[model samples]
Target: MLDIRRLHMLKTVAARGSITAAAQSLALSAGAVSQQLAALRHDVGVDLLRPDGRTVALTEAGRVLLEHADRILAAMEEAECAVAAVKGTVGATATLAALPSTVARIVAPALTALGTDHPQLAVTCLVTDQAQLRELTLGTVDVVLGQRYHHVPETMPKGIAVSPLLDDPLLVVTAADGSDERSFGLRELATHHLVVPPATTDCGQAILHACRQAGFTPTTRYVTADIAAQLALARSGLATALVPRTAIDPATPGISAAPIEDHPIQRLLFAATRRTETTNPTTAAVIAALGTAARQDHTTYLPPA
Candidate 1:
């Protein structure tokens, strides 16, 4: 009979792209992982991996087995969840990974509500900007709160399920001291020093693309990855910034905000989970809490124009 644990190791190795990386994710030694794979290969009577430079590539047999492994693992998890459901308790631990901005406004509140509603289930939240889906496949996180710009292409990896949470509009932020009364368009911001996120980020790229489409490049004097910092600079009369509505508190003093008139842009916030864990009661409960938190009114912005 095949070992379920070995199958999981193979899946992790495939997801991580290298045995060493997979070992690191699994918190096991490379030699130990190799031994397990060797034993697995012996049982299957075939080579499952081939060296492709520094990384290992799955063989034809490995690919075929991986497909089966995915289904098997998912079914096993579903079975466990079913058993727990029958017991009248969902006593499980789940980890949630989310972006920093979403952590404060959405994740925090959702966690609070989740704790109140489901006392038996425990959840841990991780803030990250790296590869969230890869982490999900590696079992490092149970749920992911991620965002994508409207202009960017959506690439959903296999075996992951995504659900939309909210549409976060990008708004023009400036000082509230009533020094600037100009109706702001993407092009109009060329005259003022701008504060924007790093160009490498999706939000930054989208904002830059919108500005270039408006026939002028912004004179960016301040570049930061934090939306709060961007707002602070705008509030202090140092620069103007384009910030997401979810990150901005409408009542924040000394900051004026208005939606972009010429070229409107917004990012879609979504929650992702492994397809295998979708039926798990804990995962469902966390997603439900996130949905509830996202439904709150974070769109209210002061009309500063």
Candidate 2:
């Protein structure tokens, strides 16, 4: 029998036009993706992709196979749903996606509360750069806490039921002593060598656009894969950074966090659940916990940038 994993390769390649993107999506090396595609070609008896300079593009036959694969995946999901329904209990399993700021401050508290009171529920948190859609699309998780930056969005994704949580303040953090640096407006702020988040991350984009609007572009001296690294960067004074208020425990000294002059930056955290499971009790409990946590940020919450 042909491998289900190879079909996933075809689907991944289809979703992300380039093989490089597919590899990143699956967290696989380029060579690994190439091997999988080779297996996929052997199974299907056709040339599914071609090398076009740096990237691979899928052929017409590849696209056709992808459509069928999508149906198969959806049906498999439906079957899983049926099984899950039959095995239903008040508490099953839930996965959560959150930014590090929320994870440290609010999410941790809520999870603690849940664990103390409701131990039966299995909760796993995947905290990193935004990949909220993964929870909903792949059925990897039952809930997601997505960050909303800049002008608030008027709408949410179609299939998800959204509940607005709270606003997270993004602030500029630097050494307290003015000897090395002094407060500056947007233009100067942009040029300052900054410690940045990942390239495609929302926090990274927020800092970039806010700087551009204020008039200059940020020269990122360093970028971190994890939010926790920002503190060390700030401690060393190697680069200035914009971080969530909660991340910086206000009581912790050596750093002065100032609201970004003239530029307002806040993140709106939202609790998202699949609309199809409107009355999931476990989801309801999770939302309640999140609401309680948001109302009272255990960690010192900052004002907008």
Candidate 3:
């Protein structure tokens, strides 16, 4: 019989491209990982990995076994879900991964509600800049809160199901002057020194595309991934900034925000989970709690029409 744990280790090695990297990810020593792989190879009676300069490549046999391993692991998850359904309890540990902004604005409240409603379900949240989609496939995280910008098209991975949560509109933030907020056209941004996220980020790329579409490039005075820093620059009158509505706290002093009237840019926020695990009571509870929290905070976001 094939060892399920060894099969999982093989998948991790394949994903990481090296035994050492996989060992680090799994929190195991390289020698321990090597020993498990050797045992798996002996039991399977085939070479599963071949070293390719500085890394290991999966052999043809390894690829075949990987396919089976995926199915086996998925089936195991389904079995667990079914058992949980019968038990009628959400008593399981689940990890959720999301961007920093989402964690603060949406996930925090959702987790609080989840804790109150389902005390038996324990969840841990990991704050990340990127979605870490591969971690979902590896079963390292049970769910992910992700965003899709209007200008950037993202293809969801196979076996992952995404459910829309809200549409977060980008706003122009400037230092407050005690005047009524008024919308600004994209063309108006050409004259102001701007603070923006790095061009390599999804939000940055979308903002850049929107600016160019308005026929003039923005004069970016500051480039930073930290939304707080961007807002700080705007608050200090150093530069104006484009920020997602969710990243702004309405009560924050010194900064005023208004939507871009002529050309609106928004990012769709969604939650992603393994298709097979959706039926799990704990996963279902978490998704529901997030939805509830989002609706409660809907006044801050622009819902998709």
Candidate 4:
């Protein structure tokens, strides 16, 4: 019989595309992962992987086994969830991945609240973005806090469940005293030198699409993947940026934010989990806590209508 643990290692390896990367993500030494892969190959009597330049690539047999591994591992997780349900306890480590900006508003408070409310359930937070959606589907994380722009909707993969959390409106951040705290028209934004997140990201694409819809392309002078970097450029009077309200630092000394007037760009924030793991008591508890925290944040931080 194939070892379940080795099968899991193989799955992680395939997802990561390299033994070293899988080892780092799993907190195992590369040698340990290699040894497990070798044992798995012996048990299955097949060549599962082959060296590809500096990294490793999965073979046809490896791809087939990896598919089976997903089902087997999911079955094992369901079995554990079943046992935990019978015990009527929610005690296990649940890992959550989210974007950097969203973490401060919702995730941090949820962590504190979960500790007080359910001492037995431990939650680990990982900072990631939409680029890591595959990690969420592969079971690298128990849940993910992701955002979807109205202009650039994301297609959730099969077997994943999403819980709507909050609506984060995109705001314009400019040099202090440059624009009043009122909505500015998209035509006005076209005249400004913009510093935006890389267009490859969902947030960036949303901004570009919204601007185009208004009949002008923004003159993007700088592109960064970091929100803070975008804000810093805006604060220095070097560029203007469209940022999610959650990403704005009200205390920052030299920047002011305003909503876009005609083209209102907003992103929907949600928590995602594997469809099969939703029934796990620990997962349910954490999801509930996230909702509570998100509601609290909206009330405390968002401007009243």
Best candidate according to lDDT: 3
lDDT of 1 by residue, 1-305 (tens): 99999999999999888999999988999999999999999989999999999899999999999999988888887788777667755566999998887876788889999889988778988887643878886678989999989988998877788889998888888889656544567778889899998899888999899988888888999999888789889989999999887777766889888778778888999999887543666777888899888886454434544
TM-score of 4: 0.88
Tens-place lDDT per residue, model 3, 1-305, is 99999999999999999999999989999999999999999999999999999999999999999999999988988998899899988876889998887766789999999889888778999999998889999888998988999778779888898888988889999999888878999999999999998999998999999999999999999999899999899999999999988787777888899989998989998988998853888888888888887777776553221
lDDT score at residue 118, model 4, on the 0-100 scale = 91
Task: Provide the RMSD of all predictions against the true structure, rounded to 1 decimal.
Answer: 2.6, 6.1, 2.5, 2.7
lDDT of 3 at 152: 80
Residue range 1-305, candidate 2, lDDT tens digits? 56767788777766566777878878899789989889878888999887767766778887788767766766665565555566564475788887667776778988998887688988988886664764465455778888788563555654567888887767777766645433446566765678888758777777777877887778888898555577667767777778887676766656767666677677778888766432666777788898888888834454322
Q: Show the lowest summed lDDT stretch of 10 residues, model 3.
A: 296-305
For all predicted structures, in order, the TM-scores are 0.89, 0.66, 0.96, 0.88
Rank all candidate structures by their lDDT, best first, as comma-separated numbers: 3, 1, 4, 2
After aligning candidate 1 to the native by TM-score, how far in Å is the CA of 71 from where it should be? Answer: 2.3
The candidate, 1 or 3, that scores higher on TM-score is 3
Counting only residues 3 or more apart in sequence or on different chains, how many pairs clash (N, Cα, C under 3 Å) in candidate 1? 0
lDDT of prediction 3: 0.89
Who is ahead in TM-score, 1 or 4? 1
lDDT of 2 at 249: 72
